[model samples]
Target chain A: MKNIPGDLKFLSSHEWARVESDGTITIGISDHAQDLLGDIVFVELPEVGQTLDAETDAAIVESVKAASDVYSPLSGEVMEVNSLLEDQPEIINTSPYEDGWFYKLTPSDLSELDNLLSPEDYSDVCED
Target chain B: MNKTPLYDAHIKLGAKMVNFSNWEMPISYSSLIEEHNAVRNAVGVFDVSHMSIFDFDGGDQVAFFEKIFANDVKKISKGNKAIYGALLNEKGGILDDLIIYNANDKFRLVSNCSTRNQNRQWFEKHAVEFGVKVIERSDMGILAIQGPEAMSKILAIKEIHAEANNLQSFGCMFDDDRLYAKTGYTGEDGLELIVPNMAINDLWDQALEVGCVPIGLGARDTLRLEAGLNLYGNDMTINNHPYESNLGWTIDMSDESRQFIGKDALLSIDQSKSQKIVGVILRDRGILRSGYEITHEQGKGEVLSGSFSPTLQSSIGLARVDQGYQENGKVFIRNKALNIEFVSPRFIRKVKMQP
Candidate 1:
């Protein structure tokens, strides 16, 4: 597989983030997290305008096998969630980086991205 | 841990491994949910060769099994079969649940993998008195092709459906040395093909190429649970009697003439005070798992087998509940309690072949 655009920031919690042109940021679970969760059947997204920290529970993803908590990628206010997940939860398991993007947020501070794992660093963690 | 013949194929397909009955077997390939759904909506093949297949040889084999098992073993003909039968002690305590294939005078038995050794010993102890032969066919391999498209897949490869219309549910076909039982743990239509050890690869290749995704024990548990089928160790055990485990129908207490192994003692069994098994569905958001405590308004219950039902879209379980506890009562899943309905084991989708 080609590189998953290393420019996107990563959280230790296995979430990936990319800043949007509107100054807001798009967020979703990393490919690794989705792979671990298996088939995602239900997703509970964060409400718009809900303030969340960089590393605290902000959403829920329940699969046919088990349920998991989706963490916020950056400390910011939630702007929008991918409502399509209500019917197409498996989309995350199939395409976590693209159609599976969960929500968007405006970063409290772009410097916090330093705490996130780079694509290389994230791959190493998953390898182990 | 021992690996089944399909271990390499499962591993190569990136199956998740788990320890089951001392064997390291694949629990699922890409996703447990997807593989699970495939079995429910379409069809899936399972590598169940780790389970023990015992062939009873020589004379009086039919008489021996009929005496030991609670099911009417005498009813099965050469090509027909019997359902899960109980080996009960004198007091009705279940020894083990197994299926007997009446391969003419010789019978081929498929038993629970975890109870393989114990079942073998029990069969041996009883065979001497009945004058029968018992040999463990450990060299045999079993592949269960189950679900709606099960018959189609097998017919596509082999002309095995000739016995479908005749081999009733829980029936078997003893073609040469192989045993094809119309039985499955999943509440789906399928055949459990027991082939010689050497034919495992060839049979597996044919089953897989015909669009049967290889399923694992994990899916097996989920599928059976959705169907409300009981697991041997979970739903019933030595400490519990067949009557108390809701297997009362299997006990042949009415056959006064047939002096079977456990008949005399079963007559004295006190069914009025037994804690019978019942099915439960969790009404809460929490996923119910095994070993969780259960308590109703009347008394306490224990979850025998529990999981998130992929088909039902809810958490379900089989529990040993107090007989007095109204079948419909509140179920305690972990610490949270939820009101669930009391129902029979007929929760699985109905298959055409099922009578």
Candidate 2:
């Protein structure tokens, strides 16, 4: 079974969002998503200040086999992007949940995280 | 989907499987880079049983093959030698790329699995006049043991070591029905063993016991790309000819007297108009993929196959560009023109394994 952090919420599409105490939310692909996309070589992160709608493409991760778009789980304005991924995209494969976080977003509404799947709900979705 | 004889073994070893040409095959086991490095630095095994094999025999077998394949069969009449060439249509467009092996009285052929049905129909249609019998041998499986220490692993098995060790590159030796050939798709010294279906699983187990880790199609593609090998469907299709696909050397044009299936059209086409296959390395921090536009000073082309080469630790690719492409070029990915360095179509040679 894949690791599903209890503190974070997930989208059915596999993005996970963790709300920071400062009201900003950190967004990254789930471990299940990174496992499916083996050996990520390139990542196209969204620019800071870019506005994104919920459940829309926010970034792209390219592996040798195929390229996949990372969806935004909540409507938000990008505050910070992961600049380390520019030279070392394989970090996503190593530490997908932590250091590999895609972007920091100031969510339009903090309650939007409630609409996403819980840890138990996301685990069931992965099994299906 | 069809499964190889070792499908269960792959599953047991935690391989990630995918559907390839209607066959459920392993695309990777541990990781693409690890498997690729294992083959380059040590030895690795690949299950290539999904490839289609055909056996042809008869008094007119040689004559039939000479007329069908672009490469000359007369050169391989001595037996136990394999020749790689293209099977083309009447218009000189590639139908498929195949390897033909002369096994004394009978000739053995292995071609792409995706084109199995079409290739069979093409062969049978042409075999009528020559009175040749084409038999599809799906009952056998193929395993490739490759890398620098590939022979060391095989030689450890005393039962077949003597014969396997003596075989020259592109040469084959048979022990009863099993054919072991010193040929491989990877740019390394190794063996491709063709064995009966029932015996394949046992052989795979033996190979694993001797420390040959299983590799998947993911690493297989990257390795072949780094080696500068051509993939049939991706690199060349029914719309491509040998001259443009960096396969002109395989065509037999020395003797116009010996007519082959696509010789006339191959000769009639203007070679000057065809784009040449060249290798390119990305100088920028981006990935180059197939169907990407490549623009040079003279004209534009398309990338046939591209990948992040594990050995070189950079993005590399093969592109078909106009004849005017020189040693320096650029490819347009995501509307950004990135500078590229041109190298030989072949990227890697056999890596020297440290003793």
Candidate 3:
């Protein structure tokens, strides 16, 4: 079974959002998502200060087999992006939940977090 | 979907199974890079049983092959040897690329699984007129052991070591119904063993016990791409001829007396004006993939097969471009034109891991 951290909220597309103490939302792909896209070789992250709408394409993750789009779970402004992934994209495969976070966002609407899936719900989604 | 004889073994090893040409085959066991590196630096085994095999016999066998196959079978007919070539239509378009093996009285042909039905139909349509009997051997399984240490690992197997000891490259040794050929698709020294379906599990187990890593189709694609080999469906198809597909060397035009199926059309076409396949290496950060548009000095073309080359630590691809296009070019990926370097279609030859 894949790990679905209780502290995080998820989109059905498999992006995880964690609300930071300062009202910022941290986003990354779920462990199940990384497992499906094996051996990620390239990661194209969104630029800082960019505005993103809810459920829009925010990033791209490429494996040897194919490329996939990483969707944004909520409308937000990109505050920070993962620079380490520019050189070491395989880190997403190794530390997807921790050091492999894609970006941090300052949310336009905090109420959108409630619309996301809970840990138990996300686990059920992964099972299916 | 169909399953190979080693399907249970692949499942037991936690392989990621995928559908490939109506067959449920393993796409990756652990990871694509690991499996690809294993084949480049060490020994790896592949369950290539999905490929189709056919046998030819009868008095008209030699004459029939001379009329159909692009390569000269008579050159390898005496000894137990093999030759790679293509089956073409009357317009010189490739029907399929295959390897033909001369096993003394009978000849063997190995072809892609995707074109199995079509190839059978084409063969049957012409076989009756030539008095040749074409028989499909669906009861057989093929295993390929490849890498720098492939020969040593295979020699450790006791069953047919003696027969395989003196086998040369492109040579074969038959022990009863089993065929051991010193040939492989990967650019490495290895053996392709054809055995009965019932005995495949035993052979696979022995190979695993002897330190051969089980490779899946994901790594198989990367390995073949790094070697600059062509995939049947991706690189060549019925609309392509030998010259455009970088397979001109496989055709034998020396024997004008032999009126092969595609000889007349091939002779009529001018080689200098045809588009050709070439290798391209990305100088940018992103990966190259198929269907990407390319703009060159002479003309425009598209990528045929592209992937992240694990061996080269860079992205490489095969692109079909106009004849005058050479050296450096630009490939458009997502509306951004990135610089690329063009080289010979083959990327590696007889590559071994450096100690």
Clashes of each: 1, 0, 0
**Model 2 accuracy (lDDT, Cα):** 0.88
In order, the TM-score of chain B in each prediction is: 0.93, 0.97, 0.97
Selected candidate, larger DockQ, 1 vs 3? 3
lDDT of 2 by residue, B147-188 (tens): 989999988755554778877778876777788888887788
True contacts kept of each: 0.44, 0.75, 0.94
Clashes of 1: 1
Instruction: Classify candidate 3 by CAPRI docking class.
Output: high
**How do the candidates rank by TM-score, highest first?**
3, 2, 1
Candidate 3: regions farther than 4 A off: B351-355
**Cα lDDT of model 3 by residue, B1-355, tens digit:** 8999999999999999999999999999999899999999999999999999998767588788888899888877785888888899999999999988877566888999999999999998889888988899999999999999888999898775576867778888678888888888778888899999999999999999999999999999988888888899899999999999988988997877988899998998889998889999999989899999988888988899998999889999999988777688999988888999899867875832110
Query: Per-residue error at B211 for model 3, in Å?
Result: 0.2
Q: Which structure is stronger by lDDT: 1 or 3?
A: 3
DockQ of each: 0.30, 0.80, 0.93
lDDT of 2 at B265: 91
Candidate with the larger TM-score of 1 and 3 = 3
Residue range with the least summed lDDT across 10 consecutive positions in model 2 chain B: B346-355
- Fraction of true interface contacts that also occur in model 3: 0.94
